[model samples]
Target: MKPSLLILIHLNDASRASIEAAFDVVYAPDSTRRSAAIAARGDTIRAVLTNGTTGLTAAEIDRMPQLELISALGAGYENLAVDHARSRGIVLVNGAGTNDHCVADHAFALLLAIVRDVPQLDRATRDGIWRDTLPMQPNVSGKRLGIVGLGNIGEKVARRGAGFDMDIAYHNRKPREGSALRYFDSVVALARWSDFLVVATPGGAGTHHLIGKPVFEALGPNGFVVNVSRGSVLDTAALAQALVTQTIAGAALDVYESEPHPPEALLTLRNVVLTPHVGGRSPEAITASVDNFLANATRHFAGKAVLTPI
Candidate 1:
């Protein structure tokens, strides 16, 4: 018999249909359904599919005594109970490189949108306000761009920055080997040197609130910041305060601390731009991610090693 799979995140009809061809799927994309499905089918579920944000907990794993595999749909598995899953010998995998370019594209889009004041300008134009009445925006090209966590997505962001003729630097736990790009030992130092700061770090306790008052203060009044990583990486309260006091010129984010619900603190700020954590979402990216997941699952079920193990 095909192994029963429990999916904790939303999947489009096509993606769901594809997965159904290979396994008996128990679809539960929300809290109510998740609880009900787990209670009813936990004994038979042999695999679980989730994203970083909608992670499977240790308690949930305990409920599913037969679960042997856990797959995160994206690069992040911050909320997954990785340690507990590992102890249970559950095979863990993620869609690491599948959405890197899409996220990088969205990060650059946010940078341009905030720096050029695009949203505000469009609104003003709609109100019949002309260019002469508005403040001039700064040029995005030929400025220093700082990146935090020089991973796959960060590398893509750097490539895009190069196209704009922007000088780029990055801060990581250690400098990436064979990379000629300038590296800073500290995030504060990088922020101090950059006109634009883009955060692409991982989430979880170690990186929670990594961007706060000190980093914002270092970014100064003329700087702009963008985040395409997990929301926990940037403190929303600190960000709102920075925007309100103009600690930094402006900020843009695809992720935030309060998710699903809009951040109430930043709602009134004109200097901030927000998107609902869609940095890695695109038709191309989604297809690649689903394909990767299917490949890994197929290999695992055939008694072969899985790809992209976390």
Candidate 2:
């Protein structure tokens, strides 16, 4: 018999089939089961397949007395009850490096859309206005690009910037050795020097609101900002205020504080672009994420070390 595992989030049919082939996959009670789901199969589950945001809580973990493994399908385990999992001797793993390219692509898309004023241009053209009346858009190529958090996704963004002949510099918690890219010691310094600032840091207490008023002021009037990382990495309120006051030229975001709903402040801003945090939703990224989770789970049950442990 295959090992039994509990899944907390909905998955594509193909991904579900893959899980079924490897484990006796059991889903949470119902799409709308609420507290009753935890009450139902809590004891029977030996492992859980979930994402970072829809994490299994401590209470849920307590109900699942047999659970030993907790897996996050994405890099974020922000909301996961990590301390409780660590205390219970549960093996915690996350799917890192699974969607680097997808995220980088989305980041670039947002930057281009905002800097080039794609939405406004489209509206103007539809209103019978021609390009001659519109002002020239800023050139994205050959500019100074600042990357926050030089992780896998940040590196990918830097590579893309290089392809465009743009100079790339990064700021991280510690300077990385053996990299040819220029490094900035602080986020404020990077923002001060950059034409475009891209945020690719992880989401958690350590990084919450890392980009706020000070960084925004540093970005200056001609600078642009793009955030493809977690929403908490940049302060939403500050961003809106900066956009309104023209503290920055323009800004684009794929993630926000409120899930499924955007902040009311950003909705009225013409210089801002927003996406529903779908940066890592491409087919390739999703496949890699599921494969990463499965491989980690297999290695874990086999008593080998799990990949990308938190």
Candidate 3:
């Protein structure tokens, strides 16, 4: 008999079909359905699929006594009950390299959109305003780019920055080994040195609000910031305050604390650009992630080690 799989995140029809071909699938993409599915089918499930934000909690893991595998469809597994799962001897895997390029591309898109004031300029042009009447925007090229994480996504962001002739640096708990890019021991120092700061770090308590008022202040009135990482990594209240007081030139984000609900405080701010947490989403990226999950799952059920263990 095929192992039963419980999927806690939304998937496209094709992706669903692909997974269904291998397992007895239970689809629950929202809170109500998730609770119901777990309560009803928890005993039958052998594997679970989720993303970082819609993580499977320790309590939920405990409910699934038969669950031997859990997989995240993206690089982050911050919300997953990793230690609890490990204690239970459940296998953990994530799609780390699958969506890095897509996220890096979106980070730059947000950076350029905010830095160049693209959305505002487009609106002005539609209303018959000319460039001569507007304030000049700064060039994205030839600037100092600071990355908050130097993982797969950060490395890709750095590579993109290089294409724009930007001098690049990064901040991690410690400097990444063999990296020639300049490293800052602290986020504040990196912000002070950066013309554009892009946050691609992981989430969880260790990094909660890692970027806040102090980092914004250090970034000064001329620097722009972009966040493609988890929302909790940047403080929304602080970002709104910074924009209101012109503490920073502008900001762009694909993720924010409010999530499914738009951040109310930043709604009226023209100095910021927002996307609905889609930095790592693309047809290509989704396909790759799904394929990676299937590969890992297939291997795990066949009594082999899974790829990309978290």
RMSD (Cα, Å) for all candidates, in order, is: 0.5, 1.7, 0.6
lDDT for each residue of candidate 3 in 84-161, tens digit (9 for 90 to 100): 999999999999999999999999999999999999999999999998999999999999999999999999999999
**TM-score of model 3 (CA atoms):** 0.99
The estimated TM-scores of all candidates read 0.99, 0.95, 0.99
After TM-score superposition, the amount by which residue 61's alpha carbon in candidate 1 deviates from its true location, in angstroms, is 0.2
Candidate 1 lDDT at 256 equals 86
lDDT tens per residue, model 1, 66-173:
999999999999999999999999999999999999999999999999999999999999999999999999999999999998999999999999999999999999
- By summed lDDT, which 10 consecutive residues of candidate 3 come out lowest? 254-263
Clashing pairs in 3: none
Off by over 4 Å in 3: none
- The top-ranked prediction according to lDDT is 3
- Candidates by lDDT, descending order: 3, 1, 2
Candidate 2 Cα outliers beyond 4 Å, as residue runs: 29-31
lDDT by residue for model 2 (121-191), tens: 99999999999999898999999999999999999999999988999999999887877899999999999
Backbone clashes in candidate 1 total 0
Superposition TM-score, candidate 1 onto the true structure: 0.99
